[model samples]
Target chain A: MIKFSINKAFFLQALNATKRAISSKNAIPILSSLKIEVNSQSITLTGSNGQISIENTISAKEENAGLLVTSSGAILLEANFFINIVSSLPDITLDFEEIDQHQVVLNSGKSEITLKGKDVEQYPRLQEVGTNNPLILETKLLKTIISETAFAASTQESRPILTGIHLVLTNHKEFKAVATDSHRMSQRKLTLDHSSDNFDVVIPSRSLREFAAVFTDDIESVEVFFSSSQILFRSEYISFYTRLLEGNYPDTDRLLVNNFETEVVFNTNALRYAMERAHLISNATQNGTVKLEVINNQVTAHVNSPEVGKVNEELDTESLSGNDLTISFNPTYLIEALKALKSETVTIRFISPIRPFTLIPSDDNENFIQLITPVRTN
Target chain B: MIKFSINKAFFLQALNATKRAISSKNAIPILSSLKIEVNSQSITLTGSNGQISIENTISAKEENAGLLVTSSGAILLEANFFINIVSSLPDITLDFEEIDQHQVVLNSGKSEITLKGKDVEQYPRLQEVGTNNPLILETKLLKTIISETAFAASTQESRPILTGIHLVLTNHKEFKAVATDSHRMSQRKLTLDHSSDNFDVVIPSRSLREFAAVFTDDIESVEVFFSSSQILFRSEYISFYTRLLEGNYPDTDRLLVNNFETEVVFNTNALRYAMERAHLISNATQNGTVKLEVINNQVTAHVNSPEVGKVNEELDTESLSGNDLTISFNPTYLIEALKALKSETVTIRFISPIRPFTLIPSDDNENFIQLITPVRTN
Candidate 1:
């Protein structure tokens, strides 16, 4: 039997980290259990699938002196319930002991629970990535890039390649992230201090979403390791691994424009409010189009649905350049882009009636661009 | 053309109350619009179906010096979009004028909007209730009574009467609210200062829900006007009307037990936590039974689901009276009852295997009582 005591605070942190390790719907029963083992100085928790495994360890303390280990053993417990109980328990030493080959005792203060366990040998093995192949980037910057561009990725299962954000590192100094659903596109650019040989990868948006949850603002750098089909992100004490999406991304450089026939700048808040109002009725229709009419110095947004009626609003613009233009686009695309914008004023450029429009921050300091294709309105 | 200037704040508030007046999915187009009319002292907004209508009036203010009313007329504007636009606009004096027979102009500061309006004659008329048969109750007390008991009402549409709480005046000064779903039940009693003739009314849960949203603690008494088929709750500024659910309510007094075979008393916190843990897995099962085994000074809660797993928790009880009993009940009902409990300790009384169980505050306050029927486990 294996018996040991763990510091409640340290154990909770490690347990929460490994909690994400277990799959909610694992086909194999053994893969769902976390393998916990006690060494002299630390306790290791391993949760794994056949492809990916996460291992976390918490150091033991002096107050846990009486902790004894009769034999080294492994057990598997239900992930969801065990985490719920441990998180709610008061800060106190936790006792873990193996009563039999398949049973383990978990006790803290007045609470004692006995749960069935699985054999440790059934746990999947973790892949080893050489330290020489790691690339480092600021954690906050990485989080910002993911937040800005991931929402534009296609959620439909038909286009599996569009579900991944294409990341390209130019000479290891500048990084770019791009996501598109064919109709709408978003891109974010940032500069990195480290230089690794040139690299390119397509990480699934779902995995980046999970990484965003675990990332905090304080961490300075995150080490990224990539193998053929899997990528791992390592922060200070946590490592997140996800399977990479496989396919060739479409070439999108031809979709961008260098010049525009008309450019209109307006406060983000005003445009957002106008689109929100238009969406109120347009949302009932199939395409949900909102028409924007920009003349010399004014812009009017018009939304009409045969079933719900119509709404037309005139908004003050900061400035307008070039010839007059009329464009109709999906209001949802504009709303999402406005929600992600960080600047007070945004400049939208229109090239032609059939071409896509480009939305960029009015201030030149921000390196983000969002492009939206205009829908043909009847 | 109808023209008026009103305070945006007052307009937004009145608009909110009026928006709720329209039916969510009404067949008549004008029934889904709010009828607005400008008079000398106030702007009245009426939203109605054929049976019910909410009329809210915002009195003119000193700022009305600039406000102009050219003509007194009524127009119907789409409730959803109009409310959203009015709320998002900056707080300022708003100018509303009819541009044509079918369009209206809404302008405030630099923002101008033209919305298509429907003919007001198509809107449904508000039902008038006689003021003679009105019952008075404290607004706060009524809100509390509804919140506590309404959640237990049956959500199934088969028994329409069960979807409403039965409100009956036992004496001139005492009122009772009772709701049940056959399996679980909740009842609350309140004392009134003024005496009224004996009365009973069944108000739909939906109307009570709307009142809960708008009711505040500052108001003292709300006058309730009852007709043959509709009930109206009148506050100082707002009148709420709801269609009564037809059919006779079940007699639940006999379901209450006068004595118990065994009573188990325990701290509310301990039992609540145990039940919550058990509920995590029990929620997945059909009947979701959580068995309670009480012996000596201990209570054990056992919840099991063949597909997910099981949870067993032992709780220390203050004391147990009479014969030892093992009872199974829905943990969700028990959890909700415990949350509504006012006392720190709760005493549960058991009568028989298939009979209802009583859960009362340890203190001998008869104002609140909750009964839950036990589900037989195989």
Candidate 2:
């Protein structure tokens, strides 16, 4: 039997941390529940979808004054059902007691909920990556790296390895994240003060996305342990682990071009707004394709649909140079990459109308670059 | 050639009003475009999806300082593309000019968009509902009547007429809106200050809902003219029309009971919360079924799923009387009814465990009543 009391806010956080790993529909019945264990000084919750497991702990420390345990035991409760119940209860603290084989009774003020649970003995045993000295990463920086590159990863079922972002660390001083979906690719690099071993890993973009959401802007750092088969990310309150995707990432270093025949710079917001408006027309009539025409010092975007008619608008550009060119690409791709660039002004470099081009921040110090393959139009 | 300039806000409102009637995908290509006509004092915009047509007018009245039209001509431009272009432009006012054969150029600040348009002569003419003397209704009051009853209408495609609300007026003094999906029903009645002719019409709930939303709350009244096949709703700025259902509505007045065997009153908010929580558990396991047991002045909602286990919660009630009752019904039905009632306290009248019941405001109200049939449980 296990009994404890916890503040509503703390309990909600524990549930949210464990929720991401629970599969919406599971073949194994035991995997549908989140296993919760209460010990002398802490309450731990674990949930898994076979490949990815997440565990969160609320310890009985000064910082966690909301938690207090009277006895120690373990039980498994349906993840979504239990979360819904606790979320709806209105009170500062809730009392939890297990009784009658595998039944959980929760009480808060005048609200009492009795939920039938499963035996913890049947729950799956989750293995964690060894706790050897791990690489420490700034939480805020890591989150930015993932968000800036994750969406460019392919979701196609054909190539499983392309679904993750390729992460590379050299001398522990520089961090790089890269992803590509064949047509477009986004890459961001950051140089840190300290050094680290030269290592390479491909983390599933979906898992990184979920992990990033768990940290706040104030979180200082997260300890990462990378084993041959799995990776562990440990923070002050949560531990997350996921199986490493097998297969080598494509060598994309050669894709980055340092020199170009032509380059045009424009205010990020101005270009993004004009592209979105053009996208509005293309998305409805064509396959989200828009053409850009660069003149002396101006660029105009044009989209013509045979049935719905045509639309063309001039975009304000800071400067245009090199060979005057007209290029066509998916407006959505550039919009997303520009968003990740996170700059006031952006520069697009082109070699030819048929060749791929690179987009980078106008400030050379920003080590982020996005590449797009222009669509061939008649 | 036609040219006009209007404040961006005024242009946006006119587009939104007519845009609702334009189908997402229309078989007739011209239906995808919104017809714009600039007259001496006002600009009129119209869009139609065959069955429903909406027309909005922005006149040069003192109140409409946002509009200033210099030419009088009509042209048709793709609705979605034009709206998208106009929305993305930045400035207080936007200038519109027809150039070439059928090209419309829109300019705002430094942004200019040239969109191709179709000949206005090919656009289909919208028919209007005839009128002798139309019934006038307060914009606010009509909106309330539609919202209170629309959701109860049947959405099943088998019976087209059941998808409408039967609106009736006796001598224009009393107004009633009623809708039923066979299993559940909602009705609201109000006594008008002015008189109207005895009129009965079954208006599609969707059309009434759309028409009601187009009016501003401050509008004093809307002149409604009902024809044999269509209904016209005319306001100060918008004119709307929709087709009427041909079938007669079922007699639902007899379903309401004047007295009750057992009446239980509960705080609306408290009851709603408990029901939503219970619904969360039952929605996944069962067919959204929940059982209510009323005994000894307490009401307990219980849901049991052999596979997912069981959950039961007690809802606080103010007063209980008549007899002991164990009833089963979809919690969603009562929740929606209570929302429509919009009252502090609610009273649920029960005839028996298996019979239908009526839900009303705790304060005696003959103006509004909702009926829900109990589900049979083994």
Candidate 3:
């Protein structure tokens, strides 16, 4: 039997952290439940959705936790239902106790809730990723890398490998993260100060996104461990684990272009706003294309919808050079890539109208790049 | 030619207010467009979605408007598209000019948007609800009436008349608003100090909801005008019009009970929270029933879901009298009714197991009352 009382807000924080890994539409019935295990020193909450699992621990040493334990045990309760009960409790503190035969009682003020819990033994064991020689990554830097690349990953299930972010550590000093969906690709590279084990792994984009979100301001760094099939992101209070994609990521290094017939430099915000307006008009058109023209050192964007109307806007470009050219492509892809770049000034290089164009921050072009394949309008 | 220059934020405010009446799924193509009529002194924007129409005017006299009109004319442009263009413009001020046949050019800084405009002459005329003998109502009071009763109206369109809130002004002094969805009913009554023409009308619940939402904090009073087929809600700068629902509203006056077998008074907030928890549990059950037991002056609420779990909470009741009783009900209905009451203390009257119950504010029971028909559980 397990019996404990804890502060409501602290408990809720732990529950919310674990909830990111619990999906309601799980194939396994027990996977939809959250596992609560209590010990003398701390309390741990775990939630899993088969592909990923998150464990959050609150120790008794934390004063805000207000934790008191009479016995220690583990139980699994329906995640959403239990969350609702705790959220609506009338008091600031909650009392939890395990009764006979997989039943738990929760009390807060005058309200009492009795929930049927599943045996913790029935829950699938968390994947054990070996922790030896763990690579240390700055929490903020890792978050930036995930945000810059994960959105370019394929969401469609048909190409499962493209749905993962390809991560590589080369020469124990360089870190690279890349994601692509054939039409567009984003790559971010960072240099490390210290040496670590060199490894390459493909982590699902969803897991990377969730892992990045789990970081709080207090978590300075994350320790990453990679096994043959699983990867772990461990911080001070939370452990996020996900199964690695088994297939090899596609080779996209050759796709990066260093040559261009024309290049235009733009203030990122100005171009993004113009592209947004163009997108608003193109969204109503049949083909959803925004055409751009560079002439006499000036840039203009045009969107035409025969049924609705059209928009022609002179884009704010810092400078333009090389052969004047006109190109049309899907505006959504470029808009997303620009949002991820979050640069004040970016330079876009274009070859032919049909070739893929690349956008990189003007100050740091060598470290980050976004490439988009253009559509042939003929 | 129609031409004007105005502040973007001021223009967007007018667009947003008018956009409430424009639904994209409108059957009439022109109804999806907003009509802009500019005169030397003022600009009026109108949008209609067949069911309702809203017109907002911006006057040159308003300091924030900064409106300047070089010519006076009217045009109709796609509501959503035009709004998006103006919203994303790079500058604070926008210049609009009708260039040629059915085309308008809008310029803001370096961005220029050319849009196709429908002929203003083809736009439908606003319904003429006679403004003579208008009834004046406190905007805050009318808003209160809407919130207190509108939710009980039937959302299903099978019985069109039942989807309206029946409003009656009797003896030129007593004003009452009532709505019922057959399963439940809510009634609010107020006495007007000034007299107006006695009238009875049924306004569609959706229109009343929209009308209430249009009121900003600055609007203190609304002038109401009623015609045979349409009702108009007019404020200083906005005129809201909707067609009244045809057919007679059902008689619900007899449903209010003056006699009861059991009566329990409760602190409205405490009861509401308890019912909310019960609702959380009952929502997962097949029948969604919350049972209430009042025995020996103690009240306990119980919710049982065989598949999920159960909750038994001792309620905080002010006072309970009459014989012992056990009643099961759809907790959602009571929860909504209690929320609408917005009263510190409430008295709930029960007649029998199968009969309807009534909830009224303990302070002013006669002015407002909510009646809910209990579910019959054998």
Candidate 4:
């Protein structure tokens, strides 16, 4: 049994953070309970699954001396319901005491609840990945790279390697992340101020996404550690870990081309608006095609479905410099690319009618590249 | 061919409003299209289903008018895709011309395409609901009443009459709305400065909800007209009609008791927070019972489920003037009642453990009352 008094606001935040560490599956009942231990100066909470675990400690002012050691024990309680009650309780003092061999009493003010708990010995321990020289990078830059490239990872289970983003760190300050679904690809580059030896690893996109969601508070830097088969991200208070996919990523550098015969520059907002309109009709069909016709000085968007008719709109263009080209591609790709772009105007370069096109920022300073392969239309 | 040009923003808003007038079913294809008719000074767009129809006209400037009447005709175009394309186009002059017997060319600069059009004569005519001396009420007030009372209406189809909220207007410048689903009930009252003859009507909650969504611009008053089987809400720019559900609504007046044996007052926020926590566990069970125990000066919420465990919370109360009572009711009902309250404190009146209880604003000047029936718990 553990008893402690904690600041209500601070405790609520810490509980929320710890709750995300537990999984909902009851396959391992002990894994769902939050382990609480009180010391002289602070209370510590540890939540873990077999693969990953998060430990959070909040410091408190002690009113009694010698740690007050009323009880120092661990009990497994239901996670979902426990988090809800803790966040709603009005009082800051949480009285936790064991009632029977397996039942625990939790009291806050006039409210009292008895919950069944599992033994601490059944809970799995978290494995530590050797962090001899963890690479440190800005948290915001890492988050940006993950968001931009993670969406392109293949969601299919047939190819397990394609579901994870390939990360390669050159020296200590420069890194590249790439994700692809075979048909389309996205890549981003980030430069860090810290230095380390060159390292290469692949982390599952799902785990990376979950980490980004839980780390809402902005931090200056994050330390990344990797073992032979796993990766870990360590911040100030939480460490996120995931198993790495075992396979060699396909060579994709040769696929990107710098040459282009046709190029069109337009406002990202205008292009997005046009594509949104076309999507309304094309979305009903399986292929969802939107055709772009570019001539000497103008461009037109034509969206058609034999069953639902067609829509044509001439969107204003900034400039068009290239041979007259009519290209048809999936509109969904263009919409997503435009959404990721930060600049007002975007320049799209096309190699040929059948080749993949590149979407780059018009300002030419950002080192981001998004490529989309066009679908062949008969 | 019907050809005209109007402000794209103005046109888009009118189209969006009229699109809601179209029915999803294709029983009559013409009903899915907006009929555009060009006159000397204005262009009228009409979209209709058998039950409801909306017509909006946009006046053209003197210079914009060529009476360009090469041909006066009507055509039926698909509503969904047309509205999307028109709204997305950049703010520019739109030229519409008929290319052939069944095709219309819509061009704005280089973006031009010919779309197939259906004969306008195939469209269904709008049904006219006769009106007598219609009553006028503030739009904001009506919207508030609908939002506060509509959620309590029965969603089940077995009791058709319970799916609508009963609205009664009295000559004493007062309007009342009531809704119930047998388990819970909500009632709201508003006083109007304008006098009108007493009228009672039942309007479908869904229709009122849709009407409220389309009413973006606030107006001083809205004219309401009632027919034998239909009710019409006429704003300055749009007229919405809904068919009344046919049946005799159960008399709920007798269910409300003026006096109670015990009354308890608590902060709305505190009670709401406690109920939300209790619901976290009770929601897992079918009965969804949350036991409320009001004693000397405290109220405790207890929710127990053998399958998912139990939760108990003792909530602080401002005052408890009623005799000790233990009652169990659906926590969802109380949640909805708390949401409808506008005051900081709410007063709950109880007469018996099994009878319906009343929750009203702690302040005597507020005129909203909610009733919830207690479930029999063994």
Model 4 per-residue lDDT tens digits across residues B206-233 = 8888878766645567788877788888
**Which residue pairs collide, candidate 2?**
A171-A196, A172-A195, A172-A196, B172-B196
What is the C-alpha lDDT profile of model 1 across B1-378, one tens digit per residue? 688887777677668776776776887766878888777766678877644567776655545334457667778888877887777665477888887766887777655666778888776566667777568888887887887888889999889899899988877878889999888889888777788767788877767877776555776878988777887887766777777778898998888878888888889877787777677767767788888887775778776665555566777777787876788988889988888786899998888767899888899558888999998888
**Which of the predicted structures, 3 or 4, would earn the higher lDDT when compared with the native?**
3
Which residue runs of candidate 1 sit more than 4 Å off their true CA positions?
Answer: A1-78, A81-128, A281-287, A297-314, A375-378, B18-23, B26-31, B47-53, B61-70, B90-93, B281-287, B304-312, B352-355, B376-378
TM-scores for every candidate against the unseen true structure = 0.87, 0.92, 0.96, 0.87
Q: Which scores better on DockQ, 2 or 3? A: 3
List iRMS (one decimal) for every candidate: 3.6, 2.9, 1.5, 3.3
Clashes of each: 0, 4, 0, 1
Compared with the true structure, all predictions reach lDDT values of 0.77, 0.84, 0.91, 0.76
Candidate ordering by lDDT (highest first)? 3, 2, 1, 4
- Clash pairs for candidate 3: none
How far off is residue B280 in model 3, in Å?
Answer: 1.7
Q: Give per-residue lDDT, candidate 1, residue B162.
A: 92
Model 3 lDDT per residue over B1-378, tens place: 799999999999999999999988788888989999999999999999988999999999999998999999999998988898889988999999998887998899987888889789999987798899889999999999999999999999999999999999999999999999998999999999899999999999999999887777579999999999999999989999999999999999989868899999999998999999889889988889899888988999999888777899998888888978888899999898999988799999998878888999999978999988877777
What would you estimate as the lDDT of candidate 2?
A: 0.84
DockQ of 3: 0.73
Task: Name the runs in model 2 displaced over 4 angstroms.
Answer: A26-30, A62-65, A90-92, A109-112, A282-289, B26-30, B62-66, B90-92, B99-101, B109-112, B121-124, B218-220, B282-289
DockQ of each: 0.29, 0.42, 0.73, 0.39
Task: Give the DockQ-based CAPRI class for model 1.
Answer: acceptable
